[model samples]
Target chain A: MAEMNRFTRDHEWARRDGELVRVGISDYAQDALGDIVFVELPQPGRRVAAGEAVAEVESTKTVSSVMAPVAGEVVEVNAALASQPETINRDPFAAGWLFALRPVRVAELDDLLDETEYRKYVEELSR
Target chain B: MLRTPLFGAHEHLKARLTEFAGWEMPLSYSGVAAEHRAVRESSGVFDLCHMGRLVLEGTGVAPVLERLAPSRIATLRPGRARYTVILNGDGGIVDDVIVTRESDTRYHLCVNAVNRERVVDLLRKTADGGDTRVADLTLETAQIAVQGPDSAELVRPLLAGADFPAYMHTVRGEWEGQEIVVSRTGYTGELGVELFLPAAAAPSLWQRLVEEAVPCGLGARDTLRLEAGYPLYGHELTESVTPVAAGIGWVVDWSRSDLPARARLERDRKAPEQLLCGFSLSAPGVPRDGFPVFLDGRSVGVVTSGNMGISVGHGIGMTWLPAAHTDPGNAIEIEIRGRRIPAVVEQPPFYTRGTVRQSVD
Candidate 1:
C-alpha cells in the first residue's frame, strides 16, 4: 500500500516517500485562501523545525505562511510554482507538492494527525 | 460585525465573508479571479450598501457643501454628479466622494464607509448656523452596482419608465413597484449603474440582478478598481495625503472664488513634491502596499496600492514617487519580500479595454 498522508493543525500535509517526505498545504487550506498568486519556497538545504514557517503563499486578498509539519532539511522544492502558483489552488495534492524534506527525527511523523482525523478537524473548523 | 440589507442573499450564494469597515461583507462568491473576469468580459453585480449615503437639503445646502468640499457645488445642475474630495483646512483629503445634485435645494453625498461618521459630523458642523439640514440615510438605504459591457442591457429590463441616466447623471425611477434612485456611476471601469432603494427591498433586487449578472465580492471590487487606477480612501487618500500628490488635483475647482483649500492646493499644484504614478512590474512578484520603491538601488517612495491585475495579466500598482520620476517609461524597482523586482512607470488606467465611456442610446 502507498504511504498514508498526515496533517498538522496549521493545514500542512506530509507523506513519506522512501527516505524523503513530500509536503504541501491541504485542500481545505487552499480553498479558504481563495486564489494563490505567488508562492515563496524555502531554498534547498535550509533546515526547518516543526511549526516553523517554511514558505509564504500570497493570494489576491492576503498573504499566509505555510508551516513545516515536522523538523527537516529541505532537499528539493517545486520550481514550477514560481511561474504558475495557481497549480496549488487547482490541485493541492500530487503535482502541487511544495517540497521534499529529509526528516531529522522520523518519529516526529507520529505527532501529525491522520487523514481521517484531519477531515474531522476541518469539518469542525467550518462550524 | 454589522450585516448589510443583502446579507441573506450573500449567505444564500455561499459567499466567503470577511469583515470590512465593521461590516460582514462578501469577499468572494465563486472566486476572485473568476468574478473579476466576469466584470471585465460581461456583467457583474456588487453589494455596496456598506458605503455611506447622506442627504443635505434646504436653500443654503449648496453653499454649505461648497464651503466644506474642494469641488464647486454651486455650478452642479440637478441630475448631475461630480466626483470630489472633502478636505481639511490644511489641504489633506478627509474623504473622496461623489456628490449628486438631486435637486436645486437637495444633494446626495456618497462617502466612504470608514469615514462616514467623520463626514457627517463635518457637514453638520458646517451647517450649524444655516438653514441646511443634514440626514444620514445609510442605514435606511441599500446600494448595488451592476457593471460591465452588458450592464445597460442587464438593467434596462428592470427600469419601468425612466430612461437610463447618462454617464455622471442620476434618475429616479420605479422598479418592481418600488422607487429607487439610479446613478450612472461606478468604481469599476465599466459602463454601469448604481441603484439606491429601501433597505427592505435590497434582497429581492439583489436576487434579480444575480440572475443575470455574476455576483462579485469585495475581492473582485479591489482588483477592478486597481485596474481602473481609482484610489481607495484609506490606501491612497489618507488624512495626510493631499489630492495634489494623489494625482486628483483636477477635481479641485480653482475657478470657484470661495472654494476651501484652494490656496494650499494652488501652492502644491505649482510644485508637488511627490505625486502618484502607476507601475507595471516586469518581474514575477506582486507588489503590495507600503513596499519600498527604489531607483538606482536607493529607496525613493512606497507603493500605496498594488495587485495582480487580472485584466492586465501582470502585476500593476500605484505608488507615490518623486515628481521628477513620474514620467512614463522611467525605470523603477519595488522590493517585495526582500526581492527587488524591476518595474516601469506607466500612465493609467492600467487596463484600457474597459467600456466606461461607451455611448448608450
Candidate 2:
C-alpha cells in the first residue's frame, strides 16, 4: 500500500503506483473550490501532454480544470466521482483519486514537490 | 471595506470573508451546500446590513414616493409593505425595492446596497423643497434575516410575546429595551422575519439567534434567492432593462398616466420582442452569467443570473429570449465551455415548495 506522492503548482497530486501514476487534486484545491457538484474525467487510453487540462470540476459557483502533471496516457478513470463528486471535498487523497496514467517519462515526478515541500508551498500561498 | 455590526461575530466563528458591494461579508461558515440545505429543511440566519435602508417622513412623503416607485404608494396602509421598483425616464429599472408604510407620515425603503447612493440622491432631488425629509439609516442600523420552516418558532420568544407580523407586514418590538422592527419578508423563499435594530445592539442579538439557527452567509443567500426565482439588481435588472422585459411588468401601475417611464413601458407592453425567461438544464452543467444562449442554431440571449439549483437538483438560470421562445416548455440550448447544453424554458421558483406565504398563526 506504500505509494510516493508528488505535487504540482496547479494544485494536482500524483501518486506513484507500480508503473502507473494516480492523479487527484490536493486538499487545498478542493477547499478553495468549495462544494463540488460535478466532475468530468479524461477517458481511458487518451494521450495528454504535461499541463494539459484533462478533467473539469464544477463547484456550486465556479468551474475548475484538473491538468495533467506530466505527459502520459490515461490508463484508468474514477467513475465513482461522476455520482459522488463531493468525495473529492471529503477525501481528496485515497477514495477520491481521479485517474491513473502510465507516465511516458517517470523522471518528471522528480521535478514535482514532495510532502514537506508541498505543505510549505501551500503555507506560503496563503500568506 | 465597510463592515457590518455582525462582522465581529462572523470573525469569532472563523467565517471565510469576501468583499461584496463595498462591504467585508462572510461568504460561508461550514460550507455552501450545508447552509443552503439548513435553510430549506430547518432554519438559518443572515446579516443583511449591506442592504440599504432609507426613511422618509412628512405628510407629503406618500406623494413623493408614489411618483418615484412603480407600486401604489399613496394607497398603501400603515404596517403594510409592497415589493416594487424604481425606474428611469425610459421605463428601465433603476432598482427593485421594498416600500413599507410604517405610519401616515413615515415610510421605509429597503434597497440594494450597490444602488443605495443613486436611489437616495434621486429621492432627495425629487422631494426637494417639499415637506418630506429623507434620511439614510443603513450605517446606523443592523438588518438580520432569520429564515426557514422553523424560523418563526425560533424567533418568536426573542420578541417577548409580540404577535408575529403577517407576510409583507411589519411590527415594532423591543429587545433589552432597544426598539427593533420585525418584518415578515426575506430574499430566501421561506417563512422568515427580518429584524432591524440599532447597530450597537445587533451583535448581542445575533449571537443569541445564531445559537438556535445555522449562521448562513452570502453564498447560500445567492443560491436560495436564485432557486426562489427572485431577481438580483445588477443581474436581472439594470438601467437598460425595463420591467416589461424583465418579467415584472405587473408591478407597474399602468392606470397612473404620470407614472415614471410611462411612455417606454406602454411601448414595450404593446410589443415585447424579447422577454426574460427561466430555464433548467436537461444535462449536467452549471450555467453562469454572461454565457450565451442559443435556439435552433441561432444565438438568442445570455444568462442574466445562473447557479446550481441545490434544492431542485439541477442547473437553473435566467435569460432574455425572443417572446416566441420564452414559453414554459420551449426548448433551448446554453453554451458552456464551448459545449451546448440542452435545456428547457420553464417558469421559475425552480424550487416550488417555498413556505413564503404560509401562515405563522
Candidate 3:
C-alpha cells in the first residue's frame, strides 16, 4: 500500500490512513526547533478544527505549536514524547507522529499541499 | 551589523548566527543542550570577541575607578581581577565589569558590549581634568574562553612552562610567538581560562583549540552562567535597580566614603524594600523572561531571567519579590503561557556540581 502525505503551510503533515489520519510536523519544523526538550499533546477524544493548535513542542529556548491539519476527533496521542521528546528531532516523520484523528470531513485533506508542492513552498520560504 | 574577527571561523563551523548587541555572533554550533553538556562534563570553547575591552593608564586611573565604582580599586594588587560594577550618581548599577589591575598605572576592563560606548564616554568625561587615558580596545582585540573540568589539561600544553594563575588571577605568556593574557576567570561555574589576544591572531588560535574542545556559542554561555547564578547586565542588573535590590550589595565596600553612590547604597543596604531572588518550578516547565510571578494570587513581579535548568533537569529563574518573601522555601507561582506553575523560592547556584575551584591534572 502506498502512503500519502499532505502538508500545511504551518509545516504540519497529515497522512491519511483509511478512516483515521495521523498528524506530525515536517522535518523543516523539527530542524528549526533544535533539541526538543518537552512536548505537550492534546488529550484523546478532544475535537479540533483545522488550524487549531493541538500540540506544543518545546526546545531549549523556544516554544512552537503543532496545529491540527483538519477538523477531527483525536483518538490517540503519542505518550512516549513525555519522556523522550527528542524523538521528534530524530524521526519527525514516522515514530515522532504526534496524534491520530478520525476526521469529520475527509475531503478537507485535498486542500493541503502534496510532497512536491510542500518542497517548493519550503524553498520559496527560505529565499 | 558589526562582525567579530572570528566570524569567518564560526561560519566555517556551520554555526547558527544571530544578531546580538549590534554584533553578528554565533548562537550555537551543534546544539545548545549538547554544547552546554560538553562544558559540564568535558570541555568547550567560545568566541567572546563581541565583548568590549578597555585599557586605562596613568596615576589618575585608580582614583577615577574608585570614585565611579563601589568596590575598592586603588589598592588592588597587580595580576588580580575583581568583579565590580560601575555606578550612576543614584547608586544604580551602570554596568558590571571585571577590573584587572595589570600594573601600578595600567588596568584592563572587560565590559558588556551593549554599554561599551556609554561606559567609555562616561570614563573620559570623569578623567578630563586628570592625567589618565581611557582607550577602547574592543575592535583591536579578541577574547576566547576554554571552559569545563578538562580546560586546564587542554590549555596547559599550549602555554608550556608558564605558571597557571590561581582563580581570579591573570598570567601573561606567549603562544606561537603572539602575546596573550590568560585569566582564570569565567562566567560559567567551571575551571576555565579566558585568552585575550590580538584580533588578527584569533582565528588561528580558535581553530587550534576547537579540534579538541567543542565549539560553543552564546546559547550555551547564557545557560551556563544562569546555572552558575551569575546575573546578566540588562536582565538582573539594570540602571534603575541598584546592587542592593539585585542581591550583589556585597560588591560594595561600605567602609569607603569616597564612592559615588555611597549615600544611596548605604540607605538601600540598611533598608531594602524588595530584593532579587531565585526560584525553581515544582513541575517540568520552561520559564522565560518577563513572565509574571505571583504570591498568594497577587502579582508581585516578573521574571528577570529564566530558562530550563539544563543541568538540574527542571526550570529555574530569578525575580524580584518583597523583602519578606525573599527567603528560601517560600512558595510562589510563575505564570507561563496563561498557566501558573507552582514554584518555590530557592537560593541561586541552582546547579552546584561545578569544578570552578577544583584542580585538574
Candidate 4:
C-alpha cells in the first residue's frame, strides 16, 4: 500500500506486486554467504508462514536457510536461478528474484522495516 | 594473547581473526572456500609460527632420542628430517613431531604449540643421559608453509627456479638479509615448502609472498589438511593415543633390526581398541569433533575431525572406529546433534589429486 520495498532483519527483501509479493535474499545476505553453490527453493503454490524456512542456499563453506518474509502462497519460482545461481551474486536485484508469493495479508509486509533500518540491522550483524 | 610475528601483517591485510589453540590467528581474508580452491588449483601462504621448536645438542642426542621416541633416529642423515612420536613410558603418545638432523650431533625438533609445556617436561625427564642438552627455542623461531599444486613454481621465484628436492629435505636460502632454512615439506598433501626463519623476518616474508601470490589463513590450513587426510593433534591424537591406532605406524620403522630400547613397545603391537579412518557423510551434515560414530545402530567410534571438503565437494571427517568396523568401503553413521547420519569409510591421504606422489606415479 505504501512504498514497495520491505526488508527483514535477516536480510531478506519482499516487494509488493498486486496482491502478491516477490521475495529474495538481500545483498548483505549474499555477501555473508560467500559464493553460493546450491539452492533449494520452495515449491510453487505451497503455503508458508512468516519466518518459516522456505528455501536453502549453500555456499562452498556454509549452509544457510532462507526464511519467509511474510505469510504467503508461493505463486512462481525462479527455476532458471537454480541452474545459474551465480546470478544471485552478479545481479542480485533483478536476476536473483528467488520466488513470488500471493500474500495472505497485505498489512503484514508493513511490519518489515524500511531500507535504511535494514541497513543498520545488517551493520550490527557484521560486528 | 601471544601474537605471531606475522600478527601485524594479518591485521594490515584485513584478515578475519579467530582463536585457535590459544593463539589469535587469521582464519581468512580472501574467504575460506576461495583460499581453499586456490591451494587446490595453484598456491597459498600460511603463517604457522605458533608451532613449538626445540633443539637438542650433545654427543648422545641421537641415543637419547632413540629411547624417547617410537622410531630409530640414528639413521637420519645430516640435514634430513624424520617424523616420529614421543611416547610416554606406557607406550601412549605424547606428541608426533618432526626431528631434523641439523648436523651429525645436533637436532631441531618441532612440537605442537599446545603441547609445548608438557613436551618439554617429557624431554627434560628423558634428557638425563648425561651428555644431552635440550633447548626450548620456540619463541625465537617461526615457520610458514607455502602449499599447493603450483607451490614449487611460486617458491622458485625466491630460489631462482630450483626444485624443492624431496620430502623431509631442507635447503638454506637468504631473504630480507636473513638466513632461512627452506624445507621441502608441509602438512598439506601437495607439492609445498616450509620456511623456518627468525620471528622478525616472518611478517615481511608473509606479506611479500601474499602481495605477489595468495594469502591463506588457519581455515584453509585445516581444510587442506583434512582433504589430505592428515590428522590434527586434538582431533585424531592425544596423550592416551598410539601411533598405530591413528594409522601412522609407517613412520615407526617396525621392521628395522637396529630398533632402539623403545622397540620394547612392539611386543604389544596389536592396533588400539579404536582405529582412525576417513569418513564422508551420506547427506549434508557437518560432523564435528566428539560426534559418536555408529555401526548397525550401535555406537562404535567418534568423529575426531570434520568439515566440508571443498575440493572433493562433500562433507568429510576423521573418526576413531573400532577395529572391527574400520574396513574401507564399509558404511558407518555419525551422530550429529542427536541425529544419526550415514557415512562411508575411506583410506587416508584422502585428497591425493595434486600431491607430490602423484607426479612420480
Candidate 5:
C-alpha cells in the first residue's frame, strides 16, 4: 500500500515512485471479471505506453484486456494470482495484484486518480 | 437493455448479467463450469422466455404456409412439428423455425428472438390463403428447456403420464393442474424435455426445476448446445449460408419435385466451397466467433461458436473451412491473439458419448 496513488476509471491503479509508477488492475476490475481462470502477463522487461493494452485476464465467459495507465517498464508481477486466479475476485488489492512497473515518468499520477476521485468514477460506471 | 420476465428473479439470486440478442440475460449465478457439468451429468432447466412464439388459425393453413416455407407443410400430421427454413425466392435462408400443424386449419410457429418479427412479416406477405390469420403470441407464452441425461427421468415425475420420442418430437401433458405441451426436443443434444406453458407460471416452473434438478442459465445452455454439434442461428446457421454448408444437410429434403428450391440446393453439390468443421484445442485456448481459423498456414475461415465442453472437459469449437481441408483428422490452427496454435478437426458432438437417441429394440 503506497501513498499518493491514483486509479484509472477503466480500473487500473498506479502508485508513484521516485521516477516510475507501479501499475496493476484495480479491485473493481477483478470483481467484474469474476474468478480469473487465466492471465496472459505482459513481458517483464518490455515498455508499455499509457492507454495501451499491456496484459490480458480471461474468465470463463470473457477475456478482458488490462490497459497500461502510464508509460512504464514492467519490472514486477504477482505470480501468485497467475496460479491462484480466485485471489483476484477474493482479495484484489493486496495479495491479488496483477503486475508492477518501472514507470517512464512518476508525475503522470496527476493525470490518474486519487482514492475519492476513483470511487466517484467507479460510482458513475455502475449507473 | 431489454429484460425478460425472469429478470427480477435473476437479480434476486445475484446472477451475473450479460447482453444477449439485445436482451439482458444471466450468464451464470454460481459458476459456469458447475452449472454446465450439472446439466451434462444430471439435469438442469433454462428460462426460454426470450424466444418468440406465434399461433396461426383459420382455414387454408397449410396452403398459406407452403408458399413461403421451403419444407412441405402439407405433409405434417396434427400435433406434429416440422423444422423448416423460410427461404428467400433466390434460395437464401431467412430463419429456421419449428412449425406445428395443430389441426388442418390451425398451426403454431416458433422463431428465434432476433428474427421473430422478420419471420412473421415474411409469412404474412407470402401467405395468400384468404382464410388464414396470424397472431404473435410471444408475450402470452413461455417455454423452459429442462435438459440433460436425467432430464426426462426428473421431468417425468412432474408431467402426467405422457411420453415423447427422439429429436423433433412433441407431446401434450399436465403439470400442477395446467395442461402443458411437453416436447422431447432441445437445442442441446440431450434426451430432454422443453415445456411450453403460461407466462405467469414460468417463475414457479423455474423454481421447481431449480429445486429439483439444478437451475441452468444461458451460459450452460450455450456450452451444452455447442458440444452437441448444433448450429446457432447467427453463428453457424446464417441467411447467407445454406443448411448443407452448415453441417445440417439432414434437415433439408431434396426429393420434392414440386419445390423449386430443390434445384438450387443441388447446385451446391456441383461446387461446394465452404464446409463446416469441428475443432478442439488440447493445451489451453477457447476460440470465439470472429477468431481466425487456419489450415496449412492459410486462413480458411473464422470460428462460429465455442466453449469449454462440459462432458469432454476440453475446449471445443466449430468453424467454417474450405471443403478441401474440412475432412476429419485434418490439422488446422486457430489464431489466438496472433499465435497460430495447432488444432485438429474432429467430427462433432465433440463429446462422443451422450444419450441423444434412445436405442430401439
Candidate 6:
C-alpha cells in the first residue's frame, strides 16, 4: 500500500512510497508564486534536516525556498526541472516532484500535517 | 490606497495587484512572461494613469522651465517633446522628465509618480516671481500607453483627422467628442504612442484597446524597459546620480549659459568616476538589484536593475562601474545568494529588434 501524503507549514508536501519519500511544493504555493522561471534542486546524496532549505524556486516577481519537510538523505533529484522549470507551475503534484529522500526518522512522519489539516491551514493563509 | 480610473477594469481581468508608489496597481494580468511576449511580438496596452502629469502655461513658461531643468526649453518648437533632467546645484539629478511644447507659452510635463509633489513644489517656487503658472493635473488626467510592432494599426482607427505623429512629436485630436493628446513617445523602445485624456474617458478607452491588444501590467513593464536598457527613476537614477555619470549627458544643454547646474555638469563631463554599463550573466541565476558586482574577485560595483530578459533568454542587468571597467567584452561576476556568477559587459538595448524608429508611412 502507498503511504499517504503529508505537508509542512512552509508549503512542502511529502509522500512516502515504502522507505523512500517524494517531496514537492504544494499547489497553493505554486499558484501564489505565479510563473516559475528557474529552480535550483538539491544534489542527490545530500542530507537535510526538517525545515532546512534544499531547493530554490524563482519567479518573475521574487525568489522562494523549497524546504525539506522532514529529516532525510536525498536519493534522487528531478533532473528535468533544470531545463523546464515551468513544469512545477503546470503540474505541481505529479511530474513536478522535486526529489526523493530516505527518511532518517520514520516517526517524524506523524508530526506533519495531513491533507485535511493542510487544506484548513492554507485556507486561513488566503484569508 | 490610491486607485486609478481603470482599477475596476484590472480587477475584472483578474489581475494580480501590488502596491506601487502608494497606489494599488496591477502587477500582471494573464502572466508576466506572456504579456511581455505580446508586446514584443504584436502589441500591448498599459494603464499608466498612476504617473504624474503637470501643465505649465503663460508667456514665460519656457524660460521658467529652462531655468529649472538642464534642457534648452526655449529652443523647443511647438508640438515637439524633449527628454530632460532636473538637477540640483551639485549636478545631481532630481528627476528625469519629458517636457512637451504644446504652444509657444504652454507645455506639458510628465514626471515619475513618486516625485510629483516635489517637482510641483520646486516649479511653483521657481515661478513665484515669473509669469508662468503651474498646475498639477495628475488627478484629473489619465495616461495610457500602446506599445509594440502593431501599435499604429491598433490605434490609428480610434482617432479622427490626425495622423500618427513622428517620433517625439505630439498632436491633439478628438475621440468620441473628447479631446486627447497623442504623443509618439514610449519607454519600451518600441513603436508606440502615449494618450493623455480626461480621467472619465479612461475606462472605456482602456476597454476598447484591450479588445485589440494584450493587457500588460507593471511586471511586464519593468522587464520590457530593462531589456531596452531604459533607466528607471529610483534604480539607475537617484538624487545622488548625475546625468553625466548615468550615460544620458546628451539631454543636458551645455551651451545654455544661465542653466542651474551647467558649470558643475561641464566640470564632470570629461571624467566621471563611475559610468552606467550593461551586462549579461553566463550562469543561470537571476541577477537582481543591490547584487554586488566583482572584477577579479574584488567588489567593484552594484547592480541597479536586473531581470531575466524575456526576449534575450538570459540574465541581464545594468550597473554602475568605474570608468575603466565600463567597456564591452569586459568579464565580470555578480554575487547572487553568496554565489558568484560569471558575467560580461555589453552594449545596451540587449534586445535590439525594436521598432521605435521605424517609419509609419
**Where is model 4 more than 4 Å wrong at Cα?**
A1-5, A16-24, A33-48, A53-65, A73-102, A124-127, B160-163, B255-271, B283-286, B290-292, B335-340, B358-361
Highest DockQ: give the candidate number. Answer: 2
Docking quality category of candidate 4 according to DockQ thresholds? acceptable
Clashes of each: 0, 0, 0, 0, 0, 0
lDDT over C-alpha atoms for residue B210 of model 5: 79
lDDT of 1 by residue, B162-267 (tens): 7878999988866778988889999889999999999988888899899989999999999999999898998888888788788888887777888787777877
- Whole-model alpha-carbon lDDT for candidate 6: 0.89
Runs off by more than 4 Å, candidate 1: A42-52, A70-76, A102-108
- Summarize candidate 3's per-residue lDDT along B1-361 as a digit string, tens digits: 9999999999999999989999999999999999999999999999999899999999999899988898899889999999999998898888999999999999999999999999999899989999899999999999999999988988886665787778998888667898799989898899899999999989899989999999999989999999899999999999988887788888888788777777788777878888899999998788889999999999998999998878898889999998888889999999988889999999889999998888644
Q: Which residue pairs in candidate 5 have backbone atoms (N, alpha carbon, C) closer than 3 angstroms, thus clashing? A: none
DockQ scores for all predicted structures: 0.67, 0.74, 0.63, 0.28, 0.26, 0.69
Which consecutive 10 residues in model 2 chain B have the weakest lDDT in total?
Answer: B154-163
Q: After superposition, how far is residue A7 of candidate 4 from its true place, in Å?
A: 2.9
Worst 10 residues of 3 chain A by lDDT: A31-40
Alpha-carbon lDDT, every model: 0.90, 0.91, 0.91, 0.79, 0.76, 0.89
The reply for model 3, stretches above 4 Å from the true place, is: none
Give candidate 5 regions above 4 Å deviation: A1-8, A13-27, A35-37, A44-52, A68-87, A90-120, B1-3, B18-24, B63-79, B101-105, B164-167, B307-315, B358-361
Lowest lDDT sum, 10 consecutive residues, model 4 chain B, at B259-268
Measured with C-alpha atoms, the lDDT of residue B59 in candidate 3 is 92
Q: Model 1 chain B — which ten-residue stretch has the worst lDDT?
A: B156-165
lDDT of 6 by residue, A72-124 (tens): 99998999988888899899988999998899987787899999999999999
Worst 10 residues of 3 chain B by lDDT: B157-166
- Candidate 1 collision pairs: none
Extract clashing residue pairs from model 3: none
Q: Estimate each model's TM-score.
A: 0.93, 0.98, 0.97, 0.87, 0.83, 0.96
Residues A1-127, model 2: lDDT tens digits: 6877899989999988889889999999999999988888888999999999999998886899999998899999999998788999999998888999999998899899998999999999999
* Candidate 3 lDDT, A1-127, residue by residue in tens: 8678999999999998879999999999988888788788999999999999999898886899999999999998999988788899899999999999999999899999999999999999989
